[model samples]
Target: MAFTLLSRSPRLVICALLCIFLFSEVGVPRRASALGINYGQVGNNLPSPPHVVQLLTSLRIGKVRIYDVNPQVLSAFAGTGIELIVTVPDDLVPGMAASASQALQWVTAGVRPYFPATRVTGIAVGNEVFTGDDEQLKASLVPAMRNLHAALAQLGMDTYVRVSTANSLAVLATSYPPSQGVFTQDAAPYMAQLLRFLADTSTPFWINAYPYFAYKDDPTKVSLDYALSNPYHVGAVDPYTHLQYTSMLYAQVDAVTFAAARLGYGNVPVHVSETGWPSKGDANEAGATVENARQYNRNLLMRQVSGEGTPLRPKLRLEVYLFALFNEDMKPGPTSERNYGLYQPDMSMVYNVGLNQLSTTSAASLSLATSPATRTDVRKDFGSLCLVTSLAILLITQALLL
Candidate 1:
C-alpha cells in the first residue's frame, strides 16, 4: 500500500507543479507605468493594424508613437485606451507654416476624426529637422508647431494633444560631463525659439538619443556594459554636478536638460522619442548581438517599471519610447538600421526580454542563440524565472505531502 501511494505521489506532484506554474505566470499583474514603443511601418511585410493592435494589447504596451497619421491604425486603436503620438511629415511643414488655415485643415483632416476614441495625446511637427541641412524646413518647424497648436486650441483639443518636434542628439555640440552640455552655435537660435514655444505651451522637448551610435563610432572609448546598463559596469561621474551615471541613456537625457537650461527653459520636461538596441547587425557593427539587445532593453524596461528619473530630475520619472517596434527590412542605412525592433516582421520575438505571451520554446531558443558571455550575464541579472520555478516546486511538494 505504501509503494502504491508513493508511485501515485510522483504523478500527482508533476500535475500540481504544472498547475501552479501556469497560475503564477498568468496571475502576475503588469506594471502600471510601462514604457512606450515607436511603431514604424516602413516595411511592407509588417502585420496589419488589427493584428498589431492585438499584439500590443497582449504585451500590455499602453503608449505608442507613429511617424504618420494612418487612419487604419488610428481607427483600430479606438477604445483601446492606448495613448498615441502622431507626426506631420517634413514636406508639409512649409505649407502648414505659411497659412493658419492650412494648419487647421491638416489638423481637422488628420487628427479630429479619431481623437477622443483613439486617445491621440501628441502631434510631432517633424522628425529630426535640426540634424538635417535643410535651412528652410528647419526655419519653418517652430512656426508649423505654433500653427498646429493654435488649430488644436481652436478646436478645443489643445489641452489633450501636445505639439512638438523630435530632434537627434547630433544637435548637441557638447554633451560629455552632463553639466557642460550645449547646443551647436548654428542650432542655438532655432533651439531658443523652439524652447520658448515649448516652455510657453508646457510641452516636452523630444530627443532621439542612440547610445549604440556613440559606442559604434568609438568602441575603444565607450563601455559596452555602460551602454547596456549592466550592474557590473563602473560608470562615469559628471565633474561639475557630481552625478554618477550607470547608463549612457540617462547621461544623454540629462545633457538635453542642461542644454535646455542654458536657454532659460530648465524646467521644460524632456522626453526620449526614440531609443533601442538592434538584435542583429553587420560584422562591423559593435555591441549589436542578441544578448546585448536583450540586456539593454530588459534593463531599460526594468528602470521604466521602477519609475526612475535622470540625475537632474529625481522626482519626475523620465518618459521614454523604445524605437522601431518591428524590424523594418526596408529602412535605409547600416545593417543595424533595419534591425532595431523588439519583434520581427512575423511577430516573433528577436529574444526573450520580459515581453508577454512568450512561449517556453522561444525562451529556450533565446538562451541557445546568445553568446556564452551574454548567457552568464542574463543569468546573473534576470532571476524572475528561477524564482517562479523554485516557488512552484515548493508548492507542488507541499501539495503532494498533503
Candidate 2:
C-alpha cells in the first residue's frame, strides 16, 4: 500500500525533500554583535530622524545612544526593535536634582510618552560630569541620578529604564598597570557615592574611555599600534596582575574595573560610553589618519562581535558605544574632535570600517561566519529546522507504516 502511494505521489515526496533542503540551506539572519553607535546630532546638516532610522536599519544596527531625548528621533524609532539609550542634559541636572517634581515632570514630558514604542533602555543623566570644571554640577550628579530614578519608579519605568552618568577618563588619578587603577582624590568622594548608587540600583558605570587622547597627549611613550589594537605590537602586561593587554582600550577598561573594585563596588558593570579614532587631524596629531581610523574601528567591531572581554573581566563581554555618528562641522575643538565621526553629516561613511559592508553578501559575511562569537539567529534557525525535520520524518514514517 505504501509503495502504491509513493508511486502516485512521487512529486509530493520530491517537493517535500526540496523544501527541507532549501530551508536547511538558506542563510538565516544571524544575530549581529552587541555593538551600539553614538547618534551624535551636533551638526546642522544631519539627515532627518526617519532617514537616520532607515540608515541604521540598513546597517543592521540594533542599538543606539543619543545625547538627548529628541521627540522626533523617539517617534521615528517606534516599533523598530532598536534599543535606545537617552540622556538628561548636563545643564538640566542641577534643576532636576533640586526638585523631585521637576524630575517627574521632565520624565513625563521627555520619556514617559514614547517608551515601549521607542525602546528606551537606559537613561544617561549627564555626559562627563565628573571631568567638568563646574563644582556645583559635579555635586549634583548623584542627586540628579537619585531624583531621576525615583521619578522613573513613580512612573513604573524604573524596571525598564536604567539611570547612570557618563564620566571621562580624567576621573582616574592613576590608570597604569590596570590592577593599581584608582580614582583621583578630588573625584573619589563623589565617585564613591556614585558607585554606591550604581551598585544599589544595578546601573552600569559609563566611562568615555578614549585611548586616542592618551596617545595624542604623549605620542613618544604610547605605541600607535597598541592604541589601535594592531596585532604587530607587543602590548603591555599589568605588572601586578600579570595580565596581558594587546590594546590600550582594554587596559583602560580594566583600570576602571579595578578603580570601582577599590571603592567596594566590585560588581558594578563598567561600560564604554564613547570611544573612536579620528580620520583626520592637525599636523601635530599623531596617528589620526583614515587608515588608522579604519583599522581601529574595524578591529574594535571584530572584537565586539567575538564577544571578547577585557583580561580583568574575561567572562563578561565588554559593552562599547562608538563616538559621534557624523562629523560635526560646528564643533569647537582641535581638528581631531570633528574627525571622529564614522560618517559624514550626509550619512556617507568617512571610511570603510567594515560596518557599511556588514549586511552585504560579500567577503564581510564570510568573515563574520568564521568569527568566534555565537550568532543568535543561526542557533534559533537550527533549532527551528530540527523541529521541522523531526515532524517531516514522523509524517513520512507514518505514511510508510500505512
Candidate 3:
C-alpha cells in the first residue's frame, strides 16, 4: 500500500523536492537570463522605486530597460544585480549630436553616478527617431549614438556599456513573407547609417514589434491563436525561405533580420526592445481582452524559458524585453497604450504571466531538462527522486478518482 502519511502532508512533498534538487547527481548550473522587462514610468500612480525593485525581485526578473536614466530607479536597482538598459530620450538626441560635450555631460551627470553598482549594461541613444518624417532627428540619430559611445570611452567605461537605438516596425517596407523584408524607401537612407554604426560598435539593433496591432487591425484575417503563439496552431510559411514560423514574434524578428541582411549587416543581432499585448483597449480595438493578454504573455514566458529561437535563426535564441511593467495612467496615447502592462499601479497583476517566484524555479528546471549534459545523469537523479514526486502526484490522482 502507498504511504498514507506522505500523501497527507504537503510539507513532506516540499521536503522531498528539496532533497531531490540538493542531492541530485547532475548539478544545476547558473544560466544567463534571457528574459528582460521594460520598466516604463510615464504614469504618476506607479509604485516607488524601492517597492518596484521588491516586486521585480520577487518575480526573479534580472534585466530591465527603462525609457530614461531616472536617478531614483537607478539607485533602487543598486546591489540588486538587476542589469539595466537606460535610454537617452528622443528630445535630447539632437543636442547630443550637435555638441559632443553634451553627450559626455549627459552620461557623467545621469549614468556615471550609478555605474557598476546599478549594473547599467546598455544606453539607448534614442527611442524610434525614425517614426515621423522628422528628417533632422533621423539624420542626428547615428551622430548622437557615436557621441554617447565616445563619451563612454572617455570615461573608460566603453567596454561595459553598449550604445544603440530602438526603432519601430514602420521602418520596414515589405515584411509579408519575412524573406521579402526590406527597409522603407524613406527609412533606408537613415537605416543604412544606423546599421553601419551598429556593426562598428557591435551593438544590437533594437525594434519594437507588436503582433497585437496586426490582430487588432484585421481580426477576421489574422489568426488569434497564431498571434498569441498558442500551441498546435497552424503557423505561417515563408514561400521564398520556406521557413516555418509558429509564432508572430519570431516572424516579426526574422523580418527585421532579413531587412538587415539585405543591407549586408545580417551579422548584427536584432533585439525586441518592446512587445506586449494590452489587457484592455478602446471599443474599436479587437482581441484586446484580458484573457488574450494573459494567454499572450504566459505563452511568451514559456517560449523564453524553453530557449526557443526563430525558425530562421534557430541556434541564436531570441532576446526579448517585454514592455510596460505596470499600466501607466498618464501615458499620452490610445487606451491600448495605457493597458499594455503586466501589473497595475497597486502591484496587482493585470493578468498573471506566471510572474511568481515559482516561474524562476520553472525556468531553471526547464533549462536543466533541455541541457544534453544533464541527461547523462538523468537516470541517477530521476531514479532517486521519481518515487517522491510520483507519490505527491498519486495523492492528487487518487483524490480525483475517489
| Pairs clashing within candidate 2 | none
Clash count, candidate 3: 0
Global CA lDDT computed for model 3: 0.77
Sort order, lDDT high to low: 1, 2, 3
Q: Give the Cα lDDT of each candidate.
A: 0.78, 0.78, 0.77
lDDT tens readout by residue for model 2, 277-320: 99999999988899988898888888776767777765555788
State model 1's lDDT. Answer: 0.78
TM-score per candidate, chains pooled: 0.80, 0.81, 0.82
- Which residue segments of model 2 deviate by more than 4 Å? 1-33, 360-402
On the 0 to 100 scale, the lDDT of residue 225 in model 1 is 84
Best by TM-score: 3
lDDT of 3 at 389: 39
What would the per-residue lDDT of candidate 3 be over residues 27-79, giving only the tens digit for each residue?
32233446788999989899999999999877778779998888999999999
Q: After superposition, how far is residue 13 of candidate 1 from its true place, in Å?
A: 67
Instruction: Report per-prediction Cα RMSD to one decimal.
Output: 19.5, 17.6, 17.0
Tens digits of per-residue lDDT for model 1, 74-179: 9999998888999999999999999999999999999899989998988999899998999999999999999999999999998678899999998898788776
